[model samples]
Target: MVWGLRLFPRAGGVDELALDRALSAVDGPVRAAFALQLLEGLDESGVRELLAEAAVADPVGAMRRAARLGRPDRAGAQAMLRSGEFDPCTVQTRPSDLLRRRHRVRAAAVAAALCVVAGGLAVAVEQGARGGGEERSPAGVFAPVLDPAELMRTAAERWADTSRVDFTAWPARGGRTDDDGLLGRALRAWAEPSESVRVSTTPGTASVPPAEPPQLLFADEVDGAAVVLFHDSADRVVRYAEPLSGAGGAAIDFARTDDADVTTGAAVVVSRTADGARFLLAPWIAESTTRDLLAPDTPGRPLEVGPDGVTAEVPRPGAGGACETWPVLQLRSSERIVEKHAFLLTDLGELAPTHLTYMPKPGRGTPARQPREATGPDALVAWARTACSLRTLAGSGVRSVNNWAFAEQKLPEGGASADWVCTRADTWRGPGRVLVQFLAPAASPADPATVIADRDDTALCSKFGQHVLAGTHWRADSGRWYVLGAGSRAVTGIRATGEVRGAAGGPTLAVRAPRDADVELTASLREGGTLTAVH
Candidate 1:
């Protein structure tokens, strides 16, 4: 199926290959009529009229004869008819007009080919399009296609016209889908003239040179945010770059390198916040392969430093030398301090690395705090409760009884009791200092949840590595408490009755009970911690 179009097979007839060959043998006008009837959804009268105007007699009959000769079966014929290459609207002119248009298209194609030939004659061309080389067209004598310079210029014009832009390192590998929410904010800031916005381009910084000739790069800056886009001669986006926010820093200097280097790679994002400069070195490997490298106790000690402002280095963890060790830099001073840093091994390849750094405005600085370890059951429970509360606020519910909340609550020991129960438990941790888990009903299950929050609130959860819950609701049967919700990060707040407040300045949670209801709140604290009831 091409572009979601499928053709049916004929019974005991020639295969698609034979049908294609036969179709190629037909006259151009007859083929055009067939395409119009099949692909463009044109009526028989329309096809006949167009063919008559072109002085082609028995146009419908001729198409039928061609189909029969090709033996394409109904399906194969349909595939040929539906091919996007032919458009019936363009064929509505007189026969002479049609011929002239075709000639013009072919001439344009030939001119492009001649330009490529001229470029080739001047110097040795690389395997792929690079260094002033012309890109050869696979389709000969067809239509005009944009060169790399034209594509870049068009993209830059488009970028300047829009307030928002998204950049991804590996667009073809689904990296484009991972929106970090910074692009929107940057766009908004750019709309205001008072805001600091810069637009420029960097040469030879992309991880992978364009696979096609005429690679182009465009860069834009909004305040402290920076965005870079890489395009090929065909105007296709090959890579994107943007700075990310990091803890203890004004902005994170980071870039996604193409897999052309090593299979496993490391990334260091340096971001500046109001507090100070923050650096985060994370492994760009896959989650399953990051167990050892991202372990909580894994040592991230600096390997080396130099006079060129380079501070530390972490070797790739895998056995192969197919990976490059990334350096994690730390900046420390007496008054201002760097907050936290981490590194992990990840699975990613393709796209070259482009480095970027955004320094916070000199006078705009806030006091920095030392990073603290959030260990113990209290901390775990706090994290779990915050996660659950966010889930509840967002309207998400429990999916299965085999979740962390159920195990932590010891609900299985109750022998399938029908009592309403709520549990919050820890789940997993990301490469950085972020932890993830779930909270839900210990008995009655509900549908997947959704969160309703404004953009800024939603961004909070994303920056902190928290997946918000949505569709969460509180229901009570007898004196038992039951909460239902789903998993997501779009949750903003809960619209429920009661005074909801954040615990330890975390996510806001609230629960209301009837006057006579016996309410109990407890936590399993670890060493040097205490569980207290807030009455």
Candidate 2:
């Protein structure tokens, strides 16, 4: 007989139900001893004190007897442990109510162990008094009658019609979920948050509740605090947690989602502990890995996925500031699309991962798709080192970013080619801006290149607009100076006036001039237009 359940309709009934039935058949002291230690997660001292108040003869003997009766198959036991059954919040009887029925049981004794205040509401169980209440009863009264399987099934059925991935498909993990008190509060806060519950939302995120019951995504202890993540709908991801310092009330944070988030998934910075920041990866992701952006060719390290998709701890971004190209996480979806995400420690304690978008070259048409891994090391390394790529443009509503080498000038003494590159960032809501930098070769791979002549928002770097860039830098090796100017590839020729007099054909111009020359440079575009350089 499979799992010894031939007596019931199903053979596989040797689960928490079977265990509960076995415990109920035992004496009251035995049942109380088992539930107090196993379900409440109380120490021997706490269990003994509560059992003593209930007038049990020997707490240790009762506990030993209870363990023997309650033991189930190994698999059943693990499932039972993960399920968080018979928690005080789920059961109908409060410790106060149970104490009232016992002659020797005191409210103080039970409250010290079972009663808890969460979100300004009591989490203790409360049930109606039984008839002939003075008589002793088995502690099976505290056992939960409802099974969690039905709830999971109901949630799945509710999400069946949605096009997005069902939230029920993801296993719930994280937080001190085994802690009945904390898990109960988290569940309650999501299902029926009261006026006293605190709520927060990121810009453009929705604060409304879902049409149906929200789905549980994560529940675990993080950074010494109880944290929970729930999906209100395909469009909203909500997080509820206790204050990290234990000084303030619990709060709910909201983040808006779109098709981009669904296809690429995300890895959120859930907590920052002594070890470093912890990440919670989206459940739909097939795999997650990270590589140092500064070292583009280095092998990427695979991050181990924990229960419910949480990742192993990672080092927080160093103190080098935005100049430092922090490591990037690459999340590969089931569809085989790999996305790159950048994370930064922000004042908004819990950090959300920022999605990186790639801008196509000017004539390449609209961005064909969302950003993915760069095609080559040069592109990846260039983006990784650009100050405008990750940090400065993260929250600026950026939809895409591109780094274009507008001009390549050979060093004054035939040293090497130095590139004048402009980074164009386009926002989702329409406006775009540009940052220009000059990159000179450096000695080591660790020091990829140095950026100079950095300028921002001074020139047009869009396909629909045309402009030119000109700047002068002194060369110590050549003992002379030169004026450099460049326009888009469409430029046919360039002319210089004012203190510097010279003319050069084609898209780039380099002419020997005095260091302080006030040069007025103009460019003729192949598309029939003359544009002046912005200093």
TM-score of each: 0.23, 0.54
- Scored by lDDT, the top model is 2
Tens digit per residue, CA lDDT, model 2, 1-535: 3331222222234466776656554567877877677667777888889988887765654665555554445345545644646343442321333434454456676665554454224212222243323432121122121111111212322322335543434455654544545545554555456777787554456566455545556777676677876655545667777865778778776665444344223555566665366778755567667766566567668878776567777764443223444565666655423344332121112345544434333342332232333434555556555632344344334444556655665665675766666666654335666666556665534453333333333336566544546455444466788877766656778898898888888766777888888888898887687887653
Clashing pairs in 2: 94-125, 174-219, 174-220, 175-219, 175-220, 175-221, 176-220, 176-221
Q: Residues 328-350, candidate 1: write the lDDT tens digits.
A: 12222111111232222221111
Highest TM-score model number: 2
Off by over 4 Å in 2: 1-215, 231-236, 243-252, 262-264, 273-275, 319-325, 335-350, 357-372, 387-389, 394-412, 425-433, 446-476, 514-521, 532-535
C-alpha RMSD for every candidate: 22.8, 23.7
| Model 2: worst 10 consecutive residues (lDDT sum) | 143-152
TM-score quality measure for candidate 1: 0.23
